[model samples]
Target: MPKLLASAYKELLLLTRDIGGLAVLFLMPLLLVIVITTVQDGSFKTIKQNKIDILLVDKDKGEVSQTIHDNLRTSDMFNIIEQSNENEAQKLIQNGKYQLAIILPENLSNDLNLKIAENVDGILAKFGVDESEDLPGTIQIEPKEVKLFFDPATQFSFRNAIKSGINQMVSKIETKSIYKAFQEEISEDSNEEIFDTESFIIFKEIIPNSGKEAMIPNSTQHNIPAWSLFAIFFIILPLSINMVKEKNQGTFVRLRTHPVSYATVLGGKAIVFLLVSLIQFALMLVVGIFLFPLIDLPQLNISGRLPLLFVVALFAGLAAVGLGLLLGTIAKSQEQSAPFGATFVVILAAIGGVWVPVFAMPQLMQTLSNLSPMNWGLNAFYDVFLRNVGFIEILPEIGLLTLFFIATTFIAIIYYKRKNAV
Candidate 1:
């Protein structure tokens, strides 16, 4: 017990003396979280609070074209800039002056109405309602295309959304035209309305709640947990470097003369670094809770989940420390350990949904992400912060992290003993 405490004290002293390492561990992550959160918050607000600029070229100058223009103008999503020349609109889109443009074909309204009227007449004659010999046996109407011009830089998802919206609007207009044609044929003498144009089915979004209030996750909620986990795992870089330094300096040789096991030495390093990880997490929470709102970002709400958040952080720290121990044991020098540790952490973060979300990734990458310890930690953090889950709900992720720590630490111990054996 005395040896373990003394070893922990020595590790603490070494960490405190390295000012640059301490700065890297603490300051860089704080800045990263703040900047990333701010940028993402702006993106989140783009569709809801800001309008996209779109050019409308109505070549038809008919009821259909006018209706399309009116719909675009009325929609909160688009800021319509009417352009008379289709060629000019296309130029503007290609030059990136505008993100999108919609072109309605000439005589769209007339042709659409004629097609509907002819179809209705044919249907009425089939039902024996129209007995007139003047009814044509065949009907033909040329198809009209609505052209969409998009900026080259426009995202595929945004383009798809715009295309879908325009298609839906045109379909509604076509349906209304059909209804009017039928009404005119069925009841030419009546003055009352026949068809209801208003939508019957509407979509409603349901958010999961904890019997109190719904915990809607914003950028702050997402960035804080994600980047904090990143910062925690990044401890491996310095931790591994420190281990390599001690070996290079003959500190390990001096410690061998004492009555100590390698596990005790590992335990000492784990205790100090675990405390550092917890402190790093706490500082991140402080910044999210306090600094974000001042910068016009949403405040992070930990509320009753603080304890569970810490529990996940603790286990995540253990996993990080275990990885550091293994890397340090295997690596022969500081140059080897430092680069590998940093690069490996980045790879883990990339695959673990730290940069891009798991759901957004391809099927193969999503499958591979399960192998990362950072993914486990990130999931556990999200379960507490966003999902508002309890300890029991987060047990699976916590269990995985615990097993990772045990396995890595065990391998590191075995490797160290084998290498130094008489």
Candidate 2:
């Protein structure tokens, strides 16, 4: 007990003296979280709240074009600007001045109405409802094309959404025109409406909550947990570098002459570094809770999930410390440990859904992400923070992290004993 405490005290002393290392462990992650959250929040707002400017060229100059314009204007998704020429609208879209442009072909309204009227007259005549003998013969009318121009930089998904929306709007208009034609043919004597144009099916979004308050995940919610895990695991760089330094400085040789096991030495480093990880996590929470609102970002709401968050953070710290112990044990010099530790942490974060979300990744990458300890920690954090899950529900991820710590620490101990056995 005394030996362990002494070892822990020595590690703490060493850590406190290295001002630069302390700053790297603490400051870098806060800046990363804040910057990433701010940028992502802005993107989210742009997609959901901001309206896009679109150019409309109505060459037809008739009811169909007017209806299209009115529908687009009322949708609230676009700021429609009427352009006189299709070529001008195309030039504007190509120059990236606007993301989208709609060009209604000349005579589109006349051709569409003629086609509908001919079809309706034929149907009514077949049903013996057309009393007039002067019904016009079947006339072939070519399909009118509505040309859409998109900016070169437009995303494929955004383009597809625009195309679908425009298609649906046009289809509805055509259906309404058919209904009016049928009403004119059937109810020529009466002025009663035949078809209801109102939509019956609509979509509603449902967010799962913990029975207290609805927790809609924003950029703050996503980024805080992701970057916090990144910061925790990044402790490996400093922890491993410290180990390499101690070895190069003959501290390990001096400690070997004393009555101490390698396990005791490892325990000491783990305790201090684990505390550092926890402190890093706490600082992140503080920044998220207090500092975010000052910068016009959403405040992170932990509410009743603080204890569970701590539990995940503790285990995540253990996993990080175990990895550091293994890295330090294997690496021969500060040069080797520092770069490798930093790079490996980044790779882990990349695969762990820290940078790109797991769901957004390709299937093979998503499958591979499960192997990362950071993924386990991030999942546990999300379960507590976003999903509002309890301890029992988070056991799988917590268990995986615990096992990772045990395996890495065990291997590190074995390797150390074997290396120094002579």
Candidate 3:
């Protein structure tokens, strides 16, 4: 038993000596908080910094066509790049120099003219849609019409601007086309009556339900869970490296010869690593709750959700330790383990939406994220942090994670036993 305490003390000292371990335990988590907060600064600041670079290719020189180009360029949200050709514009967009490319067809004027004629003919031929002939002369052309091309990943404000711009252009085009037909009619002296008309275009609207007042979960709330899961999961690498260092330094073998049962040895080491992981978890939770407040964190209320939230954080840490132990046991040296451990952590974090919000991810990638612990952990976090849920809200997540921890620990033990036998 004396040897066990000495070995545990030795393990703690070895961990202290590791500069990287010290950074992970004490510094990196704080840095992550600072980075996440200061990176965007604030919403208004972000919007002010946000401007979409659009590549403009004006293949058509017609007044109407140029009007479309002019309108888009005059926008504060869009910064126009006058590229030589569509090919160059597309190259710039692909190279990430431009967020979107606007391609104006050489025959856009002709197309507009042709469409207007068709529309006028359709209206005149209608049975009861129009009955009067008070149609006005030539369509009015605004000098500020413009077309826009947007990068799919452009900021939300810019995207909305683009949508508005599109509607504005279409409405202007439709109005001008109708007026041109009326002008032709006035010049030729129409015999029958034609009705004056104005109609609104049926443009579609997209509204994201923020539910800020109602406290319902929204798309952005998922980021809190995803980021927390990945951040906690990443602590596994430091934990594993510490374990592997102990084994390589002959500390593990010396502890193995102790009079205490093997179970006790394993239990003590697991407890230490679990404590280390929990420390990291605490840092993340503190940063998440107090420092970089997410958009819609639920108020700490009468809901018994704090316990569930803590459990979620705790279970996530435990699962990470189980993974780290498995990884550490499989590698004979820290050098051998570091690469695989780091790579696996990165891949999982990326898949779990730590690198980018899941809402921004492609559908296929979003579906695939479910295979990682990041998904379940994030779901549990979101349930508490955003939904203001009770313990029941996270029970399924807790149950699943408990099963995962047990399975991973079982595998780690099996592999370690096999390694010992060898």
Candidate 4:
């Protein structure tokens, strides 16, 4: 116990003496959390407003085109500016004023009505009515298209949503047109029982999206966990370099004379770096939860999973320390450890989704991200911070990180024994 305490004291002395590295250990992540969250919070404000920039140009001088146009004018979701000229609408879209433009082609109503007349005539023939006498005659439709002009640069939240809305509007107009023809047929024949077009489609209220909306885009929810894991893993560079430097300088040689096993020495140093990692985690969380709200930024709502966060942080620290030990024991000197350790940490961070969320990555990248311990730690943190999940929900992540720590610990210890035996 005395030897272990001495080892820990020695470790802290080494770290405390390097004042600048110590500052980076604590302050850099705070700065990143604040900066990242600020940028993302601004975007969230726009999304919460739920407004769309739309330009509508209707060339068809008919009831169906006019009806759809009138609906757009009153819609709260669309901030539409109707233009009589399609060229003028195109100019506005190019100037970045609008994301989407709906161009209703000329003769749109005539083409749709022709299809409706053909359907009605078919129905009349089935019911033993003369198609020529009882039904409105069908005309040949000169096919024309409804053009959708959009600015590709505009940050349209849902591409499918805009398309779906336009489709629904067109369908409704076609339905009403067919129903008008059906009413004419009902007047001539006594079959109101089989065809009640007025009450065919029912409209239901769409409840607002639940707060569990995927990918809320809040920086506070993302930056804290992401940057915290990044900062923790960054400790590897210094930790591994210090180990190799001390070994090269004969510091380990002298320490071995003490009345303690080498494992005790290893355990003590791990404790120190692990504590540093935990401190980084706590400070980042504090800034996200308290300091951010004061600046009108998002609150770091942990969603009542503090214990799960602690468990994740604990395993994450162990994984980082184990990785550091492996690199330090394998490297021959600071020259070998410094660049290699930093590069290793950086590559792991990149793959682990410290800069981007794994859920948002390409399918192949998401699969690759699973190989990184940083990803496991980050996923666990996201579960606590974003998903409002309990400890049970994060058990798999915690277990994976724990196994990673155990595996690296064994590898590092085996290498250390081999080096010492030589």
Candidate 5:
């Protein structure tokens, strides 16, 4: 036990001696947390602000078109700008300058009036206009107006607000037409059911609101958060590659000759690298707290399982270091060890939900994820943070991760002994 403790201590001191390793153990995670948090927060803030530019081109310039344009301009939803033509509007959209553009068609008023006239109480209404300007008795015309185009950039909040405003303006015109038809039918002594039958067309069944509207789609949020945490955890690979660097520098031989067993030296190195992983985890957690509203850290009700969660996180860090150690110890040189460590970490991280969430993946991929410590570690974090689970909820994950640490550490020990035996 004393020998083991001494080995662990020596490994820890050796890791601490490397300035680059110390920086990685402490600073790299902090940097990643800062970056991800900034991006996530900025994106959500842009969505909430609901600021989108729209270009309007009115071809008709008629009263109805003007009214439609005015309606859009008056609303707080859009930053409406008048453009000379559709070409400029499209150019702006292509350049990502505007979210969407509205184009008013020529004769917009006439088209609306044509629809209005169809429901008019008239007998001698002609469908086509005469080519010759012949003398006519007189005719009253009503116009139907429409928005020729809508902006695709306008999302639900902005679109809904615009839709509501337009509906209000059009409802008055529609109501007058309805009243006129009702009076005509009443005068003709038609049965009430005839009018009632038409009323059904206007009324629709109400759709009940579903529970807990997600801020973003569940799949997007779930996968992003899960993978973000996975990256932070997978950083252990680069950190552990330093062991191979030490071996190449002759430090490994010198340390072994200084009355230290192979286990003590390697064990200490693993602990130091493991410490680095933990620091990164903490930095990510801090960034999540300060930077992204998507992650409600303080609200995470994992008090009952905090201790267990910490233990799991710590063990996961150790497991990552152990994997790195096994690879580094087996490789011929630091150059070889570095790439192998990086590739291995990346593969494990990918499978573990660093790049995607297991739940959102296919069944085959989900099964594959079970082989990665990252998958288990991230799933446990999600359980504590999102699902409000207790220690019992994550026991299996913790146990799996603990076993991974033991297995990897054993492999690393055996490999180191074989490679460095004097």
Candidate 6:
């Protein structure tokens, strides 16, 4: 207990003396949380902000053309500005005021009318009515046409969504046209239904999550966990540097002669840093809760599984501590240890999705991310924050992180014994 407590106090005193390191421990993560949260907020702004602005030129001035315009406007994904001339629409697109332009030819309505006429006559002939071609005032009709002009810079997903929506709208109009023709020719007693907007079939769509809207992601959910995990791992650099410093000063060599065992010495270092890490986790949550409102971001929300939250934090801290122990024992000098230790943590953070969401990563990279302990910590936090689940839901993540701590600690202890034996 004497060596353990003394080592813990020494670690804290050494950390307090390094003002610059102290700033990085607290300030840098805070700054990054604020900045990255703001960026993600902007990047993921609601579907309203994601809308593409399109200049719509309605040269046809027909019902079908206006119908398409109205449908596009109804969707939150598009902002349609109607214009009389294609040239003006193109100019507006060139000025970058719009990302897309659509022009409908004047013949769309006329062609549809002619098509309906032909369909109507054919149906009438099926009932033994003839001489449809002999009808007066008829002219050859062409196919309906509309032209889409989109900026090359538009996102493929967005551009494709617009295209698919328009295609569906056109199909709907054509289906209705066919239905109208059938109604004129079919008997009242006939129950066949190709298009029944009123009675035969009512279109009802079931949205996911039982029609409950998905929660839009907020800054706190991400920043709190991501930067907190990152800051915890950064313990490596300082812990490694201090170990190298003690070895340089001959303190490490002398520890061997003392009655204290190797496990006790390493345990003391782990205990001290684990406390520091727990404090770091609490500090980030405090900043998110008390300080976030000044900047308009929502505060961090802790789940009802309060003890389980600490369980996640504890295991995450232990895993980081194990890494620090390994780094501290392996390197012979501060110069050799500190930079590599920090860089290694950062790389883990990046792959583990501290800097970005795992969902956003490529398929192979997402699979690789699971190898990181940071990923386990993040999933556990997300279960608490996003899913609003209890301890049971995060058991797998907790288990993995705990296992990681044990394995790394065992390996580091064996290596430390080997190195000191020489």
- Give the count of colliding residue pairs in each prediction: 0, 0, 13, 0, 10, 0
- Model 1 TM-score (2 dp): 0.97
Question: Would you estimate the TM-scores of all the predictions?
Answer: 0.97, 0.94, 0.65, 0.83, 0.64, 0.83
lDDT of each: 0.92, 0.92, 0.66, 0.81, 0.62, 0.80
Task: Put down candidate 2 lDDT per residue, 94-182, tens digits, no spaces.
Answer: 99999999999999889999999999998888888888889876788989899999999998989999999999999999998998889
Model 1 residue 135 CA deviation in Å: 1.1
Worst 10 residues of 1 by lDDT: 206-215
lDDT by residue (1-422, candidate 4, tens digit) is 88888888899999999999898878887787788779887876655556677888889989888898788877767777778889888888888888788899988888787777788878878887744655545666676777888777765646677778888887777777888777777676544444454656688964333455444536777778888888888888888888887888899898777677777777878899999999999998899888999999978776456677878898899889988888887889888888988788888888899877677889999999999999999988877766666678898998998888788878888877777795
Tens-digit lDDT track of model 1 for 66-129: 8888998888888988899999999999999999988888889999998988888989988988
Q: How far is 366's C-alpha from truth in model 4 (Å)?
A: 3.3
Q: Of models 1 and 4, which has the larger TM-score?
A: 1
Q: In candidate 5, which residue pairs get closer than 3 Å at backbone N, Cα or C atoms, i.e. clash?
A: 7-264, 11-268, 11-269, 12-268, 25-276, 112-143, 112-144, 113-142, 113-143, 113-144
- Per-model RMSD to reference: 1.4, 1.9, 7.4, 4.2, 8.4, 4.3
* Clashing residue pairs in candidate 2 (N, C-alpha, C atoms within 3 angstroms): none
> By the lDDT metric, which is better: model 5 or model 6?
6
| Candidate 4 or 2, higher TM-score | 2
> What ranges in model 3 sit over 4 Å off?
1-14, 17-20, 40-118, 125-227, 288-306, 357-367
Candidate 6 local lDDT, 97-188, one digit each (tens)? 77889888887876886788777776676676654556545467767667777776667876787788788888888777777667655646
Cα RMSD of predicted structure 6 = 4.3
Candidate 3 accuracy as TM-score: 0.65
**Least lDDT summed over 10 consecutive residues: which range in candidate 3?**
295-304
- In order of TM-score, best first, we have 1, 2, 4, 6, 3, 5
Look at candidate 1 and tell me the lDDT of residue 122: 86
